[model samples]
Target: MRTHDWFSRKKDCDDKGDPEAVFNVLDSMLKDSLERLKNMRESIPLENVGFDSCTLEAVNSRHATLFGCLCSEGKWKTALWLRRKLIQKGAVLDVFAHNLLLNGLCKIRDMERPDCLIREMLEMGPPPNLVTYNTFIKAHCLKNNVDKALYLFSTMATDGIRPNRVTCNTLVHALCKKGLVDDAKKLLCETLSDDKEKTNSDLITSTILMDCYFRSGDTVQALGFWDQMLHKNIQIDLVAYNVLIHGLCLGQHINVAYGNFAEILKRGFIPDCFTFNTLISALCKEGKVEEACHIHDVMLKMGVAPDKISYKMIIQGLCFRGDLVKAIEFLNCLLEKSLMPEPLIWNLIIDGYGRCGDLGNALSVNNHMLSLGVAPNVFTFNALILAQIKGGNNVRAYSLKKEMLLNGLFPDLVTYNMLISAACISGHIAFALDLYDEMLRKGIEPDIITYTELIRGYCMRGNVKEAEKLSTKMRRSGSQIDHVPCKILIKKYCHLGEHDMAFHLYQNWLMREK
Candidate 1:
């Protein structure tokens, strides 16, 4: 129903009254839309009444008398400058010349190539009128240049040009977007005072101003604007409500956001995919997994099929909660419904599996990630290394580590820690020490966990002298030694009847606790 009103005006001459005139009007309308064509689907009729040459001849003409015809034909906004440029190249001008050029250049907003021509027009003796200024203001507003626009607007009355409703809306939106809330409110008040029908009469522009306030994280001001718009009985679009909901959700003001949505529904603004996703993501961010899941169910009950992103959010929420079984089930269900998970989804599962110490499952998930054509990232490799090392798959873990190095994912301290833990557990204390040294050489200092594992490995090997030396070095380096490793050294020395060394170990543990 919201089509271009292309078939109205000058339709007074019916088919029988003037067949040629009716055809002319119909032909002109479809030849163009408002501005630049997004796509040229059947841009022109292939069959042109057997006059293809005549149709081709209508391409670009610079005569000002052709303004009415040009405006009636293809979009003139972007074409305005080009036409004016041709006119400056010694083309003749006519009465409708300024109107055609104005509509082409400013009306539809093809400012991309209007710079030089616009300057030339400004320098010309023929001054622009109110409509021209309004068009220019709208262009500036659209481009978010409120300052220049405001300067131009303040001088409008000096040029015998009065700002209209559209002009007021543009100024308000530009000011609001530029963080000039008080200025926008003042302008809004002025417009409302001067023009009784200005506030609510143009819902589209008012809604746009409301959105500017909404996106600024000014909920109170945004709602205030919304209430004002409503008092004027302005129509609210679904996207407008969705935008407010997005701000509310982002700000974690969910209760009020929900209230807005309820009112939106009452006002006939239907919720859509974007609406659901924003709310679900917000809840998930707050770690409210239950609320997120409930929302997902609500989406389905409303007969709206959850999109891949919706399922992804739920899976990530479950994964964060360590509910792997449910996450896996949900993943399987997603696949059952033919939803191929994106790379992000794969990363979530890999991270989940790694955190749960299920290296085998983690690797499986990673393999599936690769199979889905998702290239592994640094975080993916980090998770994979942690899982492999913790699961005792040292050989595969090392192999993967080598591959990770080859793929440019240099092992950081955490990666080295996981691999070193595996090495220490396998009685490869020398290898663990080598890794620790390499980590230090790479400027990756080992953490408390790393040194503890190394000390424990040394203690287990009856290398009490080496363990004591390492512990003293760790303490000097500001790394705290733990009790379990101390217990290991003490128990080993006690079992061997080395009472002095055992007593020394006990003394070290007692000192560490302090």
Candidate 2:
């Protein structure tokens, strides 16, 4: 923390009658290290650092704000160190600074320390301000300690500080999030009556109530509040409309969502990205691809440019319809908009074709993904590997698994599982065993499907002994021998006319289930 040269430079610049140069020198010195920053704060006279009111406030405000953020992030030690440095610098304690410290302590849930700070604020020096109380109230509310928040709110008036809109809104949001919509509504009504300005009519509180009601599956009360807002002539913003639209869409009231959308437009409030995206995504989910496409066209007609997500939603819809060609066309439009293709979109297209039994088109889409310069990640390879295996080309699937490793991507457990199942299917029981060992060596734990595949392979080859051994191993591995595999074994025993063994297996499995 030696500052010999920096102090000399500061004095030299100050003597040269360039105050700005002196400030610059101090700034550079303090920026070097937090320790140095603390040292400078203590050693340098504020008057020498161009001690105009603004400059002094700026320096103190920066320190307090930075420490507050650190506290919020739970960096308790750093925040404490900064506070100690400020105290050592003989900095005057202001309400804002105290609030910052209290805010941080509250964020870390340091219950005792916050009470101590509150005591210090009230008894020692600078008293707690409205911001101070609000911070504590917000912290308590966030932790679902609404009773404590309510206590603080009640105490605010005794201290001659009226709760503002922010305080009320914080409580309202917290109550709604906790699904206490009735309490939130009651609070909002009380706040509106007390304010007399009706300032809470901007639809934010109503939106929260509406969302809470929708989430609780009380759509009747949600719509009633909407009507109440309309009757009261509360100005509806696009955000309010979006909330209503999204809620209706989620409730599967598609026609109602559409009506809200049309009403929004009729009121001359143009639909934003959220409005269009919600309708499009909901319609797509309901297998109404044509209607989603029509909405996209409407967006274009209204000069509301669709974003990357909007296009992705439509592409997903088209893929669901097995219209890969149209999906790719929409993808190209997305690229034209300067949005880079994501692996998720590519995987969706691959899976869509794969599920349709169109392996050729799926591979073509994968190659197109490469041409677009987006390297296939694990998900990409996973989808393609599954597709290749489903097409009865286990050899190609195996090669792709190797290529995945060569491209610096480790094959995941799914890749190994698919390979094992593929080998078992082709009657290469020994190879499947070797693959299972390799998976174990790589720390890939076998799931029920892996054991079932091997067990099925053994039973198919009439090696019931090895099949039972693997089943025992699978059960020991903490997974139950699933019904399908158990049924296979019982049938094999019955075919061999071993009715006693078949009954034993069924009884044991039923006992374990119970």
| Highest TM-score against the true fold, candidate | 2
lDDT of 2 at 466: 94
Which consecutive 10 residues in model 2 have the weakest lDDT in total?
1-10
TM-score of each: 0.60, 0.72
Q: Cα lDDT of all candidates, in order?
A: 0.73, 0.83
Name the runs in model 1 displaced over 4 angstroms.
Answer: 1-85, 88-114, 124-180, 187-222, 247-256, 301-305, 329-340, 408-417, 420-514
TM-score of candidate 2 versus the correct structure, residues matched by position: 0.72
lDDT of 2 by residue, 315-411 (tens): 9889878898889888888888889878889988998887776789889989988998989888788788888888988899889989998899998
Clashing pairs in 2: none
Candidate 1 weakest lDDT stretch, 10 residues: 1-10
lDDT of 1 by residue, 1-514 (tens): 1122333423663323544665786677767653335334234333332545554344323355456566666656435654555455434333235545655555445665443444555576246666667767777777777776887788788777777777887787778777787787788667555656654545656576667776777777767766776686766678768877887786789988888878877887668888889889988899998898888888888777889989999999999899888888878878888888876777788888887788878878888778877788767887887777667678877787788878877887777888888888899998998898898898997877887788778867778788777777877897655676667667878878999979976876787678
